[model samples]
Target: MQLLIMRHGEAGWHSLDQERMLTETGRHQVAECAAQIAASPWRPVQIWSSPYIRARQTAAIVSEILNCPVEEKIFITPEDDPGLCLDALLENQHSPLMLVSHMPLVGSLATLLVDGHRRGIPFMTAQAVVLDMPVVGPGCADLKTQFLP
Candidate 1:
């Protein structure tokens, strides 16, 4: 199975984090990354996104481009635990899964899967990392490719 971890595009400031929406540049950035994925064999079969507005927006763009369905996951929020997110991801049998989330969660989840640690690696806005894992678990995945917008 392939796991694609992506950070949401740039978002404008809002009083509430949940209500923060993507900026015009953010949409274009997400579209660029989505197009890159569509051109590659790493196109996800399904996209799992955080319920956050920016993440959902990012997922929507990828969903349209890749023609894949999107599912909102609560565990994928910015401050949510990566371990719990991993468990939830395991519950689904979908291969080539794409996750659209926020900074800390996205970065931490990628490191957890690839290096077995929660130490986050920074991701630029709308950056994506692809991992190839036979079975989803800590330190079980190999870095495959990346997409940036």
Candidate 2:
């Protein structure tokens, strides 16, 4: 299964907890990333996004191009726990999955998947990481691939 992890585009910090929206640049970033995803050899079967407006908007753009439904997961909550999201990924073994989320979570998730521990990795706006999970020996796994926008 291929896991595509994406961080939402540039979101303006207008107010705390006010559900910040994406900037014009952010929208363009989304468009660019969406085009890349469409042109890439890999494709996701489904998209999972954070409930945050920025994340949802980015996912919506990609979903429009991919023609797939977006599945909102609470694990991508405002106060996110990367491990929980990883657990969610593990629980859903469906292949070619895409997750649209925030900075720390996206970076943390990638770091965890690759290094098996929390390592801070800054994600560019609209950037994504693609990881291939190899099923072997009753649940042991490792990071396979990582990509960016």
Candidate 3:
């Protein structure tokens, strides 16, 4: 299975917190990122995102381009632990799964997947981290790819 972790594009602080909308730059970033993914060999079977407006909007663009359903979850939020979210995502991993989330959480998950520790980090906006899981076995998953937007 391939897990793709993505972070929402640049957002206005006030709008992100209040209006919950993406900035013009953010919209363009999402579009470009979606285009890149569409042109790539990596295609997601399922797309998951945070309920936050910026994340939802970004996921919508990717979903449209990838032709995949996007589900919203609170596990990707700032208030949630990224490890739990990672575990939830692993449990549901079916191959080529995409997760759109925030900065620190995304970074922490990537760090944990690649480094075996969170270490309090941050993933850049529109970054995608891919993990490979064994087709069958006890330790089924391992980090495979990490892409930056």
Candidate 4:
């Protein structure tokens, strides 16, 4: 299976973190990154995202470009466990799936899938990494490529 993990674009600070929206620059950055994905051979069959506003916005952009539906997953919240997210992925039947989420979660998920640990790979805003996973387990995937805007 191919998994595409993306970090949401830059967002302005808000008292309620979950309600924060992406900035104008963030939209542009996400659009540019989405264009890159549109040009690639990998097109996600399904898209999943955290229910947070910014993450949903990012997933919206990707969904529009990729012409795929987006599902808001409660388990992919910023503070949620990466293991739960992994298990969620394993439960899904979609191939070439895309997940739009927040910082530490995106990084932690990548690390857990690639390194067999939760050390995490740092992710920039609006950046995405593609992983080729033979099986949905730790250290069973390879980093295929990355997209940055």
- Cα lDDT of all candidates, in order? 0.93, 0.78, 0.75, 0.93
| Model 2 per-residue lDDT tens digits across residues 1-149 | 67888888888989664388898989888878877777876678899999888889989988998887899987885458887887677678567889899878887777777667766588898887777667411123355544444
Backbone clash total for model 3 is: 1
Model 2, C-alpha of 66: deviation from truth (Å): 1.3
CA RMSD for every model?
0.8, 2.7, 2.8, 0.7
Q: Comparing candidate 3 with candidate 4, which one achieves the higher TM-score?
A: 4
Q: How many backbone clashes does candidate 4 have?
A: 0
Cα displacement (angstroms), candidate 3, residue 43, comes to 0.9
The Cα error of candidate 2 at residue 116, in Å, is 0.2
lDDT order of candidates, best first?
Answer: 4, 1, 2, 3
Two-way TM-score contest, 2 vs 4, winner? 4
Tens digits of lDDT, candidate 3, 34-146: 77777777789889889888889889988988899999887897556867876686578456888898877787776666566777456677767676755422244576666
Per-residue C-alpha lDDT of model 4 across residues 74-119, encoded as one tens digit per residue: 9998888999999988898998999999978999999999999998
Error of 4 at 22 (Å): 0.4
Error of 2 at 20 (Å): 0.5
Could you tell me every candidate's TM-score relative to the true structure? Answer: 0.97, 0.88, 0.85, 0.98
